[model samples]
Target: MALAWQGVRALARREWCSSWRQPAEWLTPLAFVIGVALMFPLGLGPEPARLRELAPGLLWIAALLASLLPLPRLFAADLADGSLEQWWLAPLPRPLAVALKLAVHWGWTGLPLVLLAPLLALAFGVDDAAPLALSLLLGTPVLTLLGGLGAALVLHARAGAGLLALLLLPLQVPVLVFGTAAAQGGNNAPVALLLLGAWLAVLLALAPWGIAATLSLMLD
Candidate 1:
């Protein structure tokens, strides 16, 4: 057990280091999130009540789109450089490696959005940053996890990014709806969060294997 965890940590650290070397990997999505938050006010007018009203949905949409920016690059570089083959054949469990990669991806992309969401909420005149932060906390993982599945599904495709967006956006509808409702402090916040949590749990159990299998087939 100790050895397995060590391997997972090692792989995660390696992935993190590789990504850290490339500022654009994390920064581009972050910039997009910040840009959307800033731009909507100009287009929507500067009324506090109106900005507050739109903050939940607008921020959620921006976060969702920004999440997409990193998916295509998630496994592409590894595959191109032949590092993915080493991961698949390593002594460490395949799913664990995949899960670690997903965790790292979320840490870089989804986590930044969650942390910055409150500031964006504040900018949009949202007094209760709690709901916005909480909604993202529950919602972004779903995007990242299911996104891994889509990323793997279209890994070597001609237009992987377009296919990834098409594959993920429809499945992400429930998450978006519930996340927006939670951000808006609707009556169903608890139920919505619980549902999102359930969705995340399902992805955690399933996505790693799906990613590993798809990659295995493609690489073999």
Candidate 2:
């Protein structure tokens, strides 16, 4: 257990340093989210009520799209540099390693989106940004986990980016629906939040193993 944690910390440190060096990897998605939020008011006109009504869906969609921008690079760097091969031979389990890496990936890519969501929600005229913020808090990690699986599956493909979006967007629909509903904060908001939490739990349980298996097959 101690050794596993040590490995996780080491992997976390390495990933953090790598992500820090490449500003665009983390920054582009943030910029995309902001751009999408800003564009809606221009396109839809400056009605706070209408914008507030639409804010939940628009913000969730932006977050969903922005999450994709960083995914292709998730495993590409490790795979290219032979770090994944070393991981295969390490004492740590592949699924655990995948989860750890995804956790770090979420820290760089998903965390910013979560942090920025409330501000975007306000910009969209949401009366209370708390529900939107709460929804994103539970939802972004799921996005990162699903994205990691998608990234691993398409890592070797020539047009992996396009394929990643295609594969991931459909799977993300449930999250989109529930997250938007939760952010909208109706009588059903609690239900939606619960469902979102359930989805997160389910994905966390399954995604790492799926990613690990996919990478193992690719490595073999």
Candidate 3:
């Protein structure tokens, strides 16, 4: 048991270091999210009320789109360097390893979006940004987990990034709907947040195994 935990820690450390070194991999997605948020005011005119009305959906959409930028490469580096095979062969359970990787992926990619959501919300003229931030907090993990699954499914496909987006967007609609509703803030916000939490819990229980299975198929 101790040995298994040690392996998990080692893999976690390695993923953290690897991701830390690649600033662009994480930063680009954040930049994209910010860019999209900024563009809305310009395109839609500087009407605060209109922007505020649209803020929840626009922010969620921007976050969703930005998330795609980092996912295609989630396993690509490990695969190219043979690290994935080594990890697969190790004693650590593949699902645990996948879960750790997805968590780390969320740390770098999804967390930033969640953190920056409030600032983007403010820019969209949202007076109380808490709902937006809260919604993103609950929802981004689902995006990352689902995205990890899509990334694994398309790892060897031609134009894998685009394929990952296409495969994932449909699967992400529920999250999008609930997340946007939560962000919009009102009587419906609590219910929307609850649904997002439920979705996150379900995906947390299932996505790692799904990703691991897809990866096993790829490696074989």
Candidate 4:
């Protein structure tokens, strides 16, 4: 148990360190999240009323786009230098190892949006600020998990993260719809949170297999 926990932490730390070493990976997504969010006012005519109505959709879409930017690097970084082969042979369990990596990746990307959401909401004059941010906290995990799946799914492609996003973007629609619906102050926050969490949990269970499979195939 201790060994696995240590491995998970090390895995997370490794990803975090690599990301921080290249601040662009971290900064660019955040800049994009904030930038795409700012566009809401112009596209929707800038009325506070209009901004309030549209903020949820705007934030959700921007968040997903922000999440995609770092994904291709997920495995390719390790694979490029033959670290992936070493990962598969690690003493720690693979699923837990992958989960830790995803958790850190999302922490850098999705989790920050949760913390930074109020700014996003405030910029757009969104109401029910607490619920809007809360919904994001709960629902954005689905986006991260799907992003993890995409990272794993496209582990070997040329421009894998870019292609991964293209593939996963369509799969993201359901989360986007429900997540926005929840954030927009409606009758569905509880239901949406529950469903989104279920989605994340499902991905947590299944995504590693795809990642592991992709690694295994690369070996053979």
Candidate 5:
């Protein structure tokens, strides 16, 4: 078991290194977060109170959208290059490998948004950074994990990117609501965070298997 996890970590690191070699894959989501944050103030006027009121939702929305940027590429490149076929044949459980890949995907795409959230929150006039950062930290993984299932489902479809967005956006609605509510840190914040955590836990347990199955079906 320990050895399997070690392989998972090693595979994840290799995937991260490959993505790092292509700057655009991981960087675009971070850029989207900043760009979307910038636009909120421009479109809504620069009132501190108003921006703060809107910041939770705005940032959550941006993070959600940015999460999607890497979905299509998650399995597309591996499929194209036959790496996925190799994975299928490996002694390692394919679902475990998918879990590691999704973890790395969140590390590249979602972790930055969590780290960057505090600064962006201040810019948008959110006074407390903890709630925002914590909410994103817990919530973004759910996005990436859920997205992995969607990405796997559409891996071989025509215009898979568009299909991915269409499949995922509806599922993301609950995440958006709970995440934004948690970030706002009001009376219901704890409840919202608990819900997000529950959702994350469920996804963590089930999504990798679903993704693995979908990808195998696609490949077959």
Candidate 6:
């Protein structure tokens, strides 16, 4: 059990290291957060009060968009190198392997942005920072689950990562709606977070089987 988890961690680290070498992969998420947050002030004419009113909405949008940026390359590179096939051959349950991969993906991406939410909220004039931050925390895993689905689906894409964002963006609506609504005008973001967690649990349970079944059919 411990060894399986250790392998998962190692695989995730490899993904992280590979991505780190190609820094361009991060530009969209970083720019999207800063740019969208800045727009709140511009769109609301820089009135602190008005900016505060829209802060929760703006921050949630940024977080959602940021989380969406990495889905393409999340598994594409590994899949290209046959690492994904190696994972399939591991002695561990393939679903467990998929879950570990998702966990690692979340650890590298969503988890950091969640930790950075406070600064982003401030930039967007979010007076009630807790809600936006909490919303990000709860919602990012949902992004992972659903986004992982998108990532896995597109792992074989020849357009590479270019079309991934286009493919996955539409599927992110529910998370954004619930997440922003939770942060809109209040600090009670727990319910939305719960929903996100539930979504993640469902995906974690099902992703491996789905991926394995797809692979088996492809191999046949």
Candidate with best lDDT = 3
lDDT of 1 by residue, 87-202 (tens): 97677888889999999988988898888877999889887788889889889999998888889889989999999999999998888999998888868888888888888888
Judging by lDDT, tell me the better candidate of 4 and 5: 5
**Across residues 1-220, which tens digit of lDDT does each residue of candidate 2 receive?**
8987788888878888998999999899999999999999999998988999999999999999999998888899899999999888777899988998998888888888778776798788776888998999999998998899899999899999999999999999999999999999979899999998998999999999999999999888
What's the CA RMSD of model 6 in angstroms? 2.9
Report the lDDT tens digits of candidate 5 across residue range 43-86: 99979899999899989998999889888888999988888997
**Model 5 worst lDDT run, 10 consecutive residues:** 3-12
Worst 10 residues of 2 by lDDT: 118-127
For residue 152, model 1's alpha carbon misses the true position, in angstroms, by 0.4
Candidate lDDT scores, in order, read 0.88, 0.90, 0.91, 0.77, 0.89, 0.71
> How well does candidate 6 match the true structure in TM-score terms?
0.81
RMSD of each candidate? 1.1, 1.1, 1.0, 1.9, 1.4, 2.9
- Writing each residue's lDDT as its tens digit, candidate 3 over 109-204 gives 888887887789878988888899899999999999999998999999989987888899999998999999999988999999999999999999
- Where's the lowest-lDDT run of ten residues in candidate 4? 210-219
Top TM-score hit: 3
Clashing pairs in 3: none
Ranking by lDDT: 3, 2, 5, 1, 4, 6
Model 3 scores a C-alpha lDDT of: 0.91
Q: Higher-TM-score candidate among 1 and 5?
A: 1
After superposition, which runs of candidate 4 have C-alpha atoms over 4 Å from their true positions? Answer: 1-5, 159-162
Off by over 4 Å in 5: 1-6
Off by over 4 Å in 3: none
Clashes of each: 0, 0, 0, 1, 0, 0
